[model samples]
Target: MITAAPHTTPGVLDGIVVADFSRVLAGPYATMMLADMGATVIKVESPTGDDTRAWQPPVREDMATYFLSVNRNKHAIALDLRDDDDLDTAHKLLAKADVFIENWKPGGLAKFGMDPEAVAERYPELVHASITGFGTTGGAHLPGYDLLAQAASGLMDITGEPESSGQKAGVAIFDVVTGLHATVGILGALQERQRSGKGQHIAVNLMSSALSGLVNQTSAYVAGGVVPTRMGNDHPSLAPYGPFAAADQPLILGVGNDRQFRQLTTALGASELADDERYATNPARNAHRDELRATLETYLQHRPASEWVEEFRELGIPCSEVFSIAQGVEFADEIGLAPVQLTGAEKVPTVKHPIDYSRSQVAYDKAPPTLNEDRQSILEWLDAEEG
Candidate 1:
C-alpha cells in the first residue's frame, strides 16, 4: 500500500503521456501502475510483437497470458525503431510526452537513437525511466533476469525448503519488485519536474531491487557477522512460527511471546506444556523447537487445519490454515481485498490497484490494450500534432 504521497489526484500524473518502449514484465508493469494513476501510456511494440506475446500455456482469446497479465489499459502501436520512418514517428510522440520508459539491453536503444540520454538532451522536460537487467553501472555489461538476479543477490541461497536447496521463487518476484521501484522513481521525478520545470533520468534494475528486498537477512548478514541459512518453513527468531501439519492440512502459526504461547498451548489442550521449563520462554521454545513441534503435532493431528486455525485465532495466537492459490484469492475477496479486476472501456484484465487511496482514486478504469490496438488513433494524434 505504498502510495505516492502529498499529491491528491485529479490523479497525481494526470495528463502525462508515457511513451513505453519496453517489452516484457518490468517496464510494462511500471507503466501499468502509472496508467492506473492517470498517466496516458502508449505502448510501442516491434513488428514481431513484444516477446511475451508468444509466451503461452494458459492461453485465452489467442493472446499470450504472459502478455495479458502485465499489460492492460494501454494503447499499443507497432513500430520499428531501426527504421527511419518509425523512429521519426516515435520521436514525434516523444516531443510531446512527459515520460518515456524503455528496457532495451544496455546501449540497445542507443543504436536506434532512442537512448534516454539522447532523448533527455532533446526534451529536458520528459521524465525518463530506464529499466535494465543489470544496472547501467558497475555490472552494466552483465545480463540480468529475475532468476539470475535472485541467484546473484543471494536471495535464492535462502529462499526455499532447506531440502530443496533454496531456489528461486516460483514467480518472477525481482522483476515485479524492480518494476515497482521504477514506477516510484518515475513518480518522484515527475514531482521534481514540477519544481524545476525539467525532468531527470531515473533507472531501476532487478539486481538492486532483489538486494533491497532482502531487508532483515541482509542487515543481519552485514552487521551481525552472520551468514543467513535456509530456515525453510521457520522464522529465525520466532518460536513455533512455521507450518504445522493438522489433520486435514498444514497450518501456519505464530506464537509471538509467552502469553500467546500459553494461549496456543491451551487451545491445543496441552496447557501443562506451556509451563514446562523448556517451552516456557520464546528462546527456550526455539531451542527445543523440534520437541515443541512434536508436541503440537500430536495434538493437531486430532483436528483439521481449519479447526485449529479457528481455535488458535480465538485464543489470540497469530495463526492461519495454509490455503491453495484459489483459496487465497477467495479469501482476499471475502475480506474485501480485491485481487482481480477488469478495466472499464476496454474489458481488459487488470488486477486491482494495490494502493487504497482515501483521497485520490486510482486512474485505471479500463483494461489493458491489444497489440497495436490504438495504432490508428495514436498515429492520428501524432499526425495531428504537426498541425
Candidate 2:
C-alpha cells in the first residue's frame, strides 16, 4: 500500500469556486483536480444522484469505490433541474461559480437553459466547460460512453493483438485523458480570463480526445499513411521494446535508441548482437525484430525476470517485470512516489496527484461526499449569495 503525504498544503485555486454539474468519470475527474487544488467544488447531482453511486461491489463504507475514485474533495447536493426551486438553486450556484463543468450530451442542457452557449451568454465571466462523447457537429446526438468512444475513435482497433478482436483498455483511459484535457482547458481559460476580463467556453469530447491520445498510432496513419494494426506487446517501430519471457515471469524492455539497444545487449552478455548489421540501427533492428526477440529471449530465459530488471536498470536500460496492480502500488511506495493519499476524517486510500509542484502541493483533506450530503449548507450559502 502507498503511504499518504501530510495533507496540509494549501491549494493554488484556493478562492476559485466550481459548480460541478458533471457525473461519472470525465467531468468529475476534471473537477476533482480543481478541488484538490483548493477550489470549492459543489457537485450538483440529479435527484437520483450521480449514476456511479450505484456502481458497487468494490465498496468502502458501503459507498461505491467507483464514485469515490473521482469525486473527492468536493461537496455534493441533489438538484432536480426539472423543478423551478432546484433550478433556481443551480442558477445561483453557477452565478457565483468561477468555473462550471458538465458532461450532459451535446445540447442536452439547452432545455434547462444551462447549455454551453446559454451559460456563456448568461455568465460571460464564468469558465464553462462541456464534455461530450462527440462534438456538436455531425455526431452530437450520440451518447458519451468510454467504450463507445474507444471503438469509434479507432483506439480499440489498435489495441490488442493483430490476430485478435479489438479490446477496450483496462481502464476508461479515454475518459481520464479527456478529463485531463478538460482540466487544462479550464485552467487555460481561467488564465486568459485575467487578460480578457471575460470567460470562454471550453469544449472537449471523448472521440476527439481519444483520437488525439492515440498519439503515434494515429500519427502513423495520418502522417505516414500507414494504417497501424495491433501488435500486442510488440511496438510498431521499436525492436527489443516489448515483453520477453524470463525463467520465472515476463520482463518488459524499452530500448529507445541504438545506444540503449547496445547497452541492453552488453548487459545481457550478448554484446555481439549489437555489431550485427541487421541489429545495428533502430530501423534495421525493427526490421529483424523476430530474429532479435528469439536471440534475446534465449539469454533472458536463463534467469528470473527480477534479476534481469535490477541488472538492466543499473546499466541504464529501461526494463521491469510485469507487475500486478497491487505490486505496482507497492513498487511506487518503495520508490517514494507516495502513490496513495489518506483523505477525510476516515482516512480513505486515494491516489495522490501525480505531478509534483515545487511551491504548492495538492491538498487532500476532504473525502468524497455522500449524495446530497451538503444540501442544507450549500443551499444556505447560495441563499446568501449577492447579485
- For candidate 1, write residues 1-387 as lDDT tens digits: 112221245665667789989888989888888877777788899988898888887676887778877786577899987789989999998897889898888888787666877878888998988888788878888876788899988888887777776787878998999999998898889889999999878888888898788888888788898888888888788889999998988999987889998888888788999899999999999899989899899999999998888767766789987778789888899988888776666566556778877766675554556767778888888877678
Candidate 2: clashing pairs of residues: none
lDDT of 1: 0.82
Clashing pairs in 1: 72-368, 73-367, 73-368, 343-366, 343-367, 344-365, 344-366
The digit string of per-residue lDDT tens for model 2 on 1-387 reads 111222466668877889999999999999999888878889999989999999997999999999999988888899999999999888988899999999998777999999877888999999999998988899889989999999988888888888889888999999999999999999999999999999999899999999899999989989999998888989998888889999998999999999999999899888999999999999999899999999999999899999999998888999988989999999999999999999888798899977778898687777898899989888877766652
Q: What is the TM-score of each predicted model, taking all chains together?
A: 0.92, 0.97
Tell me the lDDT of candidate 2: 0.89
Model 1's C-alpha root-mean-square deviation from the true structure amounts to 3.8
In order, the Cα lDDT scores of the candidates are 0.82, 0.89
For candidate 1, give the lDDT of residue 89. 91
Best by lDDT: 2
